[model samples]
Target: MLGALLWGVVAASSLTLGALLALGRRWSDRVIGGVLAFGAGALISSVAFELSEEGTRTAGPLPVAIGLAVGALSFYLATRALERIGRRGGGGTAGLPLALGALLDGVPEQAVLGIGIASGEGVSIALLVAIFVSNLPEGIGSASDLLKAGRSRRVVLGLWLAVSVACALATIGGYGAAQVAGPGFSGVVDGFAAGALLVMLVDSMIPEAREKAGEIAGLLTVLGFAVGAGLSVLG
Candidate 1:
């Protein structure tokens, strides 16, 4: 349990780190776009190699498929509600979608990390790196936009810190849950994380990266996928 908490904190800390980086300097669109693209690629690799594959192996394709459908639908509904709220709030909504994505997805992601830890396989390096790398750009992009939208630095930092703490706790929660749940539950969690991530990548991250980085975003995404996939194979 303690190990899960520590690993969770380590993984989720990147959000705060990214926020701090964003607060420290003005990042160009290209840089932010590149980071987003790279993160997106890493996430794609994680969903494929770490989450989906493991889930399928653990339970079977049926539970994973059901989880994928449910997870995707949940994200869609939640995001739509958040978008409406953002529209009503005007510019204060800047960078909010990314933050929303992070919050929705982070729980399951960290929970999966906890499940893995409980299984006695120790930490999954691929999943850990993917979560950390993906979170950095989310923090940077969201904090930068929030700052531009007239939110104070303290408010932005506070928001991310809250998100970090919540995600960190998910690890402990997952550890506890996994102790009683069947193997199928782990598979479902894995599928759910993959589904949420896929939606976020398509609905927010990828489009934003393309807009900011132009053609280069595609190449960077490929490179990121290669690196992430390589890590999964090696680890």
Candidate 2:
């Protein structure tokens, strides 16, 4: 349990760090775009090599497929609802969608950490690195947008912190659940996360990166994917 919690915190620490960076300076849109592009690449790699591969191995194709469909659909519906509320723009939790989106993305990633630990395989270094790297730009991008939208710095930081804590708890839960259910279930969980993450990338992260950075975003994304994939192979 302690190990699971530690891994969770270590991976999620980037959220806080990213928040601080976003809050600390006035980064140009281009720079923020580049960051998002890199993050998008890392997330794609994580879903492919870390989550999907292991999921297929553990849970078999059918369960993994079901999990993926469920995850993607859930995130899509939730995001749409939240986005509509955000557009209302009447100060009724305008940043809720941003925070929830981050949580949606991070929880599954952190849960995988717990699952891996519980399986007695220790951490997936590749997944850990990918998640941590991916989160940094998410933090920066969300914070930047919220600030521009007139959100308070304290609220922004608090939201990320809350999500971080939730992710840590998710790790603990994943570890416990894995222990009870056995490793066969890991694939379903991982596949669910992968699907959710992929949808999120297409729904927001990738588009945001391109909108801010333009054509070069594609190259940066590829570069990020190469680095992430290389790390996975090495790990």
Candidate 3:
């Protein structure tokens, strides 16, 4: 839990950097889109090379697949609910679904990092650090999207704070659960997280990049994927 809470600070801090850039009114959609594309690729690849690799070895692909399906479905359901709420006049709904969905998705995964720490601090730190890096584009993208919608800084900051706190608390809970559950627990958690990320990469990042960042930017996305994958070799 402590680890996750700390990561919350990291995530918030990373976002803060992006937030400042946004406040300066110097945001670039192309840069963000490109980076997000790369991040999406990195995340998807990370699952195949890392998460699933570990998960299947620990338990079996079945349990992992089950968790992945659950996570993906959770995202789908949440998105549907958000769409309904937006249609009902959720205020600034037009430009906010993707960002909101990310907020919903990322919080628990960070908490899972906290849970993983209970068993292995080294492992927890590595995973948290990696996810933190990944969250960089996410934070920037959300802030940029809200800014483009002309949201007030007060509103943006407030929303961000609320989301961050909820994420931290959830991380604590997830970590606690994993601590009690034993080995297979991490695999299950990883499966769910990777699944959700996979969905995001495919459903959100790719389309967004193609529309905003163009092909060159898309290649950077691949580069980021390779770099993220290479990190495992260092470990």
lDDT of 1 by residue, 187-228 (tens): 888888888888988998899999998999999999889888
Model 3, clash count?
Answer: 3
In model 3, the runs with Cα more than 4 Å from the true position are 1-4, 90-95, 124-126
For model 3, how does the per-residue alpha-carbon lDDT over 83-104 read when each residue is reduced to its tens digit? 7886787555433544554555
Residues 23-135 of candidate 2 have per-residue lDDT tens digits of 99998999999998998898888888988887888778877787788778878889787767756855443334445656876887788889889888899888888888888
Lowest-sum lDDT 10-residue window in model 1: 89-98
What is the descending TM-score order? Answer: 1, 2, 3
Clashes of each: 0, 1, 3
My TM-score estimates for the predictions, one after another, are 0.96, 0.94, 0.85
Give the winner by TM-score.
1
lDDT of each: 0.89, 0.83, 0.65
Winner on TM-score (2 vs 3): 2
Clashing pairs for predicted structure model 1, backbone only: none
